[model samples]
Target: MKLQGTMLVKENELYIGGVSCKELREKYQTPLYVFDEDLVRNNCREYVKHFRVNKENNRVAYAGKAFLPIYMCKLINEEGLCLDVVSGGELYTAYKAQFPMEKILFHGNNKTIEEIKMGVELGVGRFVVDNYYELELLEKICEEKGEKQAVYFRITPGIEAHTHEYIKTGQIDSKFGFTLSNGELYNALEKLNNYKNIELVGIHAHIGSQIFEVEPYLDEVKIMMNLVKEIKESYNIDIKEVDLGGGMGVYYTEEDKPKTIKKFCEAIIEKTEEVCKKIDIKVPILIIEPGRSIVANGGSTIYTVGAMKHIKGIRTYVSVDGGMTDNIRPSLYQAGYECAIANKIGEKRKNQVTISGKCCESGDILITDTNIMDIKSGDILIISSTGAYGYSMASNYNKITKPAVVSVQNGKSKLICKRQSYEDLFKLEVV
Candidate 1:
């Protein structure tokens, strides 16, 4: 198994963040999401440290959709990174975290009036305008509030990133942003000219998520910079901020090879500088919203193995207590993950088994056809790189309760999210 974020095997046991996984399983119970706090902090610091062209002009915003608990929000706030929230709930999370209001970047494709009003009332720093409706609606809201709002036009650059089809956002046909090839962006700009309450302060574009290549980002920078120049030349509008929304990938299995954070930062910074220098325009406030890369490898989900069914001459189904209830990635994206027997790390891999979850659906497989040590009921199974969308996309299928989340650091562990109880599921149901 590929170990990450302070993971090491000591005395034939797997340990993460200096805490033994066996102990974590015994204390926190199985089907638990464990994040290395030190690793998360270090990822934040790396982005803050290396992603710079001008110290004052660059910002790193943690995309909260990946995996956000209140504790995660507080950790991000303390790490000096900005927050990018897509909905009112995330905005509220940041607000509850007491994150600096001015450091928040609000983004969404179809932001509702209530959400826009919430951001406006809370005094968020930047609103990434997605479509014409939002553009006009935001102006109306600002006019009603008698306040001026700064926004970035999220333009689709038509770059097809190499990723799953569902995740590609920068294509011309995507629902995310105004397409650059079409006249929609120009029309939006013309509309912006008539709005007095809204200020078009920047431009934003996100190609896709879980991207492994840096060339796509360079392509994104080139196209966006050209748009900045055209807007400057045609409309004399100076876009002072440029947000290339983040999709940096992380290692999941042996087949996955992602770029280092420093390399990604260096490549992006160099490309932006080159384009700015070529266009003879000063670099705008460059921002990136990294979600998965910051948290993915730092997290591991530990589950207690149970109920082994051997299909003779075919495969073995090793069941775990958790499934789509706590992690839905494998079912959703056909995502592959590396796993190991936490307590039997040193054992020889002799069994090829499919890790099945407790969910009723047969699609609830977590890791399929993977080799691991011969395992019995009650052995611990640790899946790596589950920190990103595992819990964030979790569901209560079969009405199963969600698992708890804990962060480990320096041989210490703290619960970040409490496990849902049977009663918690019916908390909102009408009696």
Candidate 2:
């Protein structure tokens, strides 16, 4: 397996952030989520440095849904990146971390009344309103508070980005945002004219997640810029911002080829400037809410091998102590991943094995038909590039406890999130 972020190998052993894998396993135990702190900060710096349309007003909001532990929030704040939250809990996490309220952008398709109230009360920077109902609801909430709230209308540009069907959000059939092709967005904008407490500051659209190309984004920019022109002509509302929401792809396995952050940012900046110049509008403040690309490659999940089963000419199943409970992407999206025996790095890749999780479901498989170094019971298995959705989307299915999370930097490791205890599973249960 190829190494990423600050990984190095010495004496036939793998090390991440200068700490040996065996050291991490010994200190944190098995089924661990490891993050490289320097890598994450570097990614943030890359965006802040390269993802510039107008350096004065453009923003890089780190989508908290990728992995929003409180520490992560603090790290993002420390790195000078804004936070993009999709739920109340994420916003609250940022609040607990003392993140600046004006740096928060609340987003969701079906945001509840409580969440809207929370965002308003907390003075969130912007609300990416999804539907007519949400727009009306936000107006009501802001009026009740006697506050003027900034907002962006999340519209579907009808661009079918090449990705898994489940993650495609920009298509016309998606459940997110007003559909741009059908005049729903125009109607929404018209309705916005009647509201007093809401300020329509921008337009937002997310094409999809794990997207691999730049052409679709370029198309999206043209369409959005045209819409911006029309909105100015028809509604007389100058769009101060345009959020081309993030779905920048990252490497998961050898087959994946993702663009560097520099290239991606340069392309976006040039395109936004070109489109604005052509359409005769001031270049709006550009924003990209990159989530996975910042965290995925910098994180890895380390699990301890438990059982192995081999059936003649069928498959070799290598079971680990953790599964769908900790990382559900493989089962949810059929996501591909690569792994290696941390302790057997130099061994010959003579084993063709399917890595299975400890979950009860047969579909709880992690990797299928992958060639890895020979594995043995008690050996440590580390899956690469799982930092994004693995912990953020984790569940307690089958009553399994989540693993501990640790961030590594400069050969030192510190636990950020503790491993869930059995008591944690039932702590909130009603007697």
Candidate 3:
């Protein structure tokens, strides 16, 4: 397995951020989400540094849907990065963290009325409006409050980006934004002209997540520029923001080859400048909301081996103390992960096994046909590239308690998210 972030070999044991994984397993217990603070913060800086083609107009907004706890929100706030929140819970987290309300961009397909009211009251920076219902609802709320809410019309560019079906949002048939081919895009823009309380300042489009290609982003920029010209000609408007919503894939395993942030920024800036010069349109605020690419590789999950099951003429099953409850990517979208025995890193690599979770369901396998060192009970297994959706999408399947999270830096560990207790599972329940 790849050594990520501060991971290093000390005395033949895996150490992340100066904290030994084996020792961490003994202290925090198995199924722990460990993040290197220095690494995560560095990623934030890297994104901000590379994506800043135009300092006046460009800003990198950290997509909170990837991983949002109060601690993460505070970290993003400290890094001077804008935030993209998709739901009320995320917004609340940001609120509690005292994040700058003016730097928060509200995003969701079906935002609740309460959420809209809260955004309007708190002065959120922008709203990436999805459909007609939400657009009208937000207009009415802003009108009632005697305020003008800035918004960006999310348009589906009919680009079939190569990615999983569940995550591809920019396609023509998707339920997300208004489709350009269906006349809804023009209609939405036409209606926005009359929305007195709404300020249409930009356009946003996201192709998909975990994407490994640069062409798709280039294609998206071209399409957005063309649309921008058409809107300017038809509606006689000047869009100040062109938010090509972020969905750059990260390295999950050796098989996955993702572009560096530098390369990605180069491709995006080159294409954007070329298109803008050709169309004679001034470059607007170039916004990209990267979530996974920023946080995925900087975090990892540590699990304890519990049981090993083997069948004649079949595969070997190595069960860990945690499974779908902690990291459900494998079960959710057939997501792949690479893991290694943290306790015994240099052991012989003669064994091939399938890693299973402690969940009762048979479909709770974490990895299959994976080659790793021999595993035994009481060994710590480190799963890499789980920083994005692992803890954010965790569940209480089979009453399993969610694991705790720790941010490690310079060999010291600080608890960010406390482990859920049994009472937490029933905190919202009644006898």
User: What are the lDDT figures for the candidates, one per model?
Assistant: 0.91, 0.92, 0.90
**Model 3, which residues run further than 4 Å from truth?**
53-56
Q: Which candidate would rank higher by lDDT, 1 or 3?
A: 1
- lDDT at position 336, candidate 1: 87
User: Could you give me the TM-score of model 1 versus the true structure?
Assistant: 0.98
For model 1, the local distance difference test gives 0.91
Leading candidate by lDDT: 2
- TM-score for each model: 0.98, 0.99, 0.98
Q: Per-residue error at 68 for model 1, in Å?
A: 1.0
Q: Candidate 3 on 220-329: residue-level lDDT in tens? A: 99999988888889999788898898889888888889988989987998899999999998877788999998889889999988889898789999999899999989
Candidate 1 per-residue lDDT, tens place, 183-232, comes to 88998888777899998889999999999999999999999888899999
| Model 1 segments more than 4 A misplaced | 53-56
